[model samples]
Target: MKNIKMTIEYDGGRYLGWQRLGDSDKTIQGKTENILTKMTGSEIEIVGSGRTDAGTHAKGQVANFKTSIDMDLPTMQEYLIRYLPQDIIVKELEEVPERFHARYHAVGKKYSYYVWNNVVPSAFERNYSFHYSEQLDLEKMNKACEKLIGRHDFIGFSALKKSKKSTVRTIDEISIQREDNLLHFTFIGEGFLYKMVRILMGTLLEIGSGITALEVIDTIFESGIRSEAGMTVPAQGLFLDEVYYN
Candidate 1:
């Protein structure tokens, strides 16, 4: 069998995330698998780098699958583009080494969150960004981002109730930028726990709004209590920007 790697981009507004569900076809992985299975005339399961929550988008999501099909990469990609839903597109495809497992081999990931901060809502960008009306203190938010950088237990910032695996993850950078009425937040990290980025965004927003003090991050780290952290932001604003492999 030959291993094939694919880079996917999806709007993710109408899907139930990336994983395949037995009862539903409303998933990115399920849709891709269905098309691949039909093309290869065999059962095909693609392994994704990671799962994005429902309504979350992706610009550079990666996956891999093993297949005995002898079709060339271009033909296979064209076939996928021809049949797969317009919202989900396989941007790139190539034959990969047998040992290249998408999830296990990922060394780091980058996520981007967008917020439409304005008194009036946007018609076109409503589905793509979170609409926040209140004024945000960027200086305060940047200060909070500094505190969240580096290695720390992030159980308080995630939705995970329990896990034997360590919750500690390294956040290399958190950048906050504004373009007109849009606020862009980028996170580069080794790995992130479930809902960690959304929760972190919420905390930072609260700090910016003066609803939560800057010291709350230190308190959450010390307590490791989920309730002590801020609310989990909506999924529509988050995007899985890229996955890095080495």
Candidate 2:
């Protein structure tokens, strides 16, 4: 058997999520599996590096699967491109070591959230970015983000009472910047809890709007309570930028 690795990009506007759901419903994994089953004539399971939430986009999501086919990498990639839907594309494919696992071997992940800070929304960006009509204080948002940059419990930024063994995670970096009317927030972390990025964005937005005090961010970090954080922003604004692996 050969282990195949693929770099995929998709617009997550219509699908439920990346993972395969029941009955092979609308999903990035389900669509890829359907095409793979047709090409390989076997029930193949592909493991993604991460499962992005519904309506969340991706630019460099990675996945790997084991297959017995003897096809060349270029041919397999070309074939997949011809069959897969337009929203999802296999950018590259390679054969890797047998022990390579996309999710398990992942070292870090990067996510970016985009916001259109304009009076009116752009039609072209409706599906890709979040629209906010209020004026944002960029300096205040940056100050708030500094509180999240290092290792912390992060319980306040995540959905509480989840079935996870631990809510403790390390955020390597948190950056907030604005160019023109686009507000970009990029996060790099060892891993993340459910809706963590979105919730963090909401809290920062509150700070930008002058509704939440900048010092409150530090207080929330100390509290480790979910209620101390801001609301979870919409998933449409979030994009899984890339997944790092060794």
lDDT of 2 by residue, 1-246 (tens): 999999999999999999899975799999998898888989999999989988999999999998998889988998999999999999989899999999999999999999999999989877888898789888888887788888878778888676557777888899977888888899999999888899999998888998888887778878878887888888888999899987
Give lDDT for model 2. 0.89
| Model 1: per-residue Cα lDDT over 170-208, one tens digit each | 999999989999999999999999999999999998898
Q: What's each prediction's TM-score?
A: 0.99, 0.96
Q: For every model in order, what is the number of clashing pairs? A: 0, 0
Local error of candidate 1 at residue 52 (angstroms): 0.6
Computed on alpha carbons, the lDDT of every model, listed in order, comes to 0.96, 0.89
The TM-score, computed over Cα atoms with residue i paired to residue i, of candidate 2 is 0.96
Which model scores highest in TM-score? 1
Error of 1 at 18 (Å): 0.5
Q: Which structure among the candidates has the greatest lDDT? A: 1
